[model samples]
Target: MAARNSAPEKRPGLISQIKTLLKFTKDVYPWLPWVLIGIIVAGIALGVGLGFLIPPVALWSIILWGVTGLMLGFLAAMITMSRLATKAMYAKIDGMPGATGYVITSGLGRGWHADETPVGVNPKTQDAVYRAIGRAGILIVGEGAEGRLSRLINEEKMRAKRVAPQVPVHVMYVGNGEGQVSIKALGKTVKALPKSISKATQAAVIKRMDSMTQGMASLPIPKGIDPTKVRAPRPR
Candidate 1:
């Protein structure tokens, strides 16, 4: 018998990834290309201008500076694209139930331990509360009307407080309503909370909370957007 042949799976190349990202971003933001071009140009001009300030500028130095500027311009463009891509993603998922959980699960940077599945959810209204533990202590993020989520948020808050009496518990609501955080800003808001607990304390709180909430019945979250497909590329 002939030996079986197999082909290895291929991941998208960097260039391909950039192209896909550009297309995705462009769909949501029509002026993305122009904005990126302008940002890149500005970055290049700034980098080359700084290079000219160096002592004893020569032809070689000018060429090197030009190259450096070009690289910096690309880097700036990438960063800008990443941010815009994130905004576009949030816009796509905004107002959908469980968006808060999706964002928390995607990431809130390092040192964050978030429960992607909401700890408290209202099946009737699709309101929910998500929890996260970090140096900032406990974050309780709620999606749904503030009035409707008040009791749910309070219950989750009380439960967290019971598990970790000393740990700080912060609450935030995600929506377009007054005083609610936008989906795009949810991660930033969570990360910006004042650090009130040490790493050890954070770990302890997470442990206690996990053990306490373990085996609790999960509520049915409204299905719509897939969190996996809603992720934005991170900036290098």
Candidate 2:
């Protein structure tokens, strides 16, 4: 009875979500035809295979294969939508000093304890080092203008060493410069680090890492700007 009563509220929300997702994809890529064509081609291939495999196929069997193909196409469209949403997201926030840290603790999966405030920031140059602690251990990511990140990374290293000398500290730079890794690749770079501690140990180390957040400069760093939030991205 209670479930039936909530159906009205639930359906419009679901419809609204679908509409928003479709709109976001349409606006960002503006190449929906290519995706549609690819999905249709895959669906048709599946239908053709099903037609060949079936015994004494009738109208019903044909309809079933068609429906199955449509379902597969729908799933493909969802995956395409997700990819486009992610690309659109990174494009908006990529170069900011806090971008590396923002993506890490939010986009990266659980088991990570990442700080929201950056560990090091040069008010003038905007060069900054953001911190995160996880099963992989302490990560210090630096981003700013060319040559600025490297020096900030060095400064942050010394501070981290002072606070927790025994814990492993990894440094990463986000930019297109000589040695810097791209923004989108930040998650992979962090995960690739040696697993320096267990989950329980990660908590304790993260607690100690709180000391590194002291005296961080305030910058106009943006937070929680998910590109997919055309409205319905957050759920009740």
Candidate 3:
């Protein structure tokens, strides 16, 4: 009974972890479909070779087949879904105020839960600055005219601080202009951070930020984008 009950308790954590890893895989390989196919073929080839290399390894073959197949399936799904997710995210925010910032931050910082939130919108022009929520803190990324970005960043920062005071906040202006964080280097910038920080620290940062930004949610998924239409994973 204890073993039975423990199995159920352990399953959710295992599943969620697999999901999180898959999400990162998708983000890293958004444009690689053939790579997924290659992985499946390779996994099968390896599995077959191992099965034959050892004499009458039928039991071992079955176990290896299942494990290899599942991993390859995840790789294929990650490839298809990563591109789909990136495109979907881009489509929703493209041409909106702070779109570039949103996209850059979306791809930045591995191992941290990042969210792009629309907190302030200009009623007249429909322009907006998105709050980029990450482990480091809340970054108010401005997307409109360069001249107006400072004000927008400030306002967004103030709003974010009211909710999450403990989290250190940074305001960044995204563009090619001087003193701004360029879009191309966005991934490099975030990834360059020291890996010494433990996952617990990152989680605590996110928790504190969430506590501060209570009630805030991500912007609605854009119309006409079917989240379900992602490419099918290669059959295992």
State which candidate has the highest lDDT.
1
Per-residue error for 175 in candidate 2, Å, reads 0.9
lDDT by residue (tens digit), candidate 1, 117-209 = 888888888888888889998899888888998999999988987888888888888888888899988888887788888999988888898
lDDT, candidate 2, at 10: 46
The predicted structure with the larger lDDT, 2 or 3, is 2
TM-score of each: 0.79, 0.78, 0.43
Name the 10 consecutive residues with the lowest summed lDDT in model 3. 227-236
Cα deviation of 136, candidate 2, in Å: 2.5
Better of 1 and 3 by lDDT: 1
Point out the worst 10-residue segment of candidate 2 by lDDT: 227-236
Off by over 4 Å in 1: 1-9, 37-72, 234-236
CA-lDDT, candidates in order:
0.83, 0.69, 0.55
User: Number of clashing residue pairs in every model?
Assistant: 0, 0, 2
TM-score ranking from best to worst? 1, 2, 3
- Distance from true position, residue 171, model 3, in Å? 1.7
Q: Best by TM-score, which number?
A: 1
How do these models rank on lDDT, best leading? 1, 2, 3
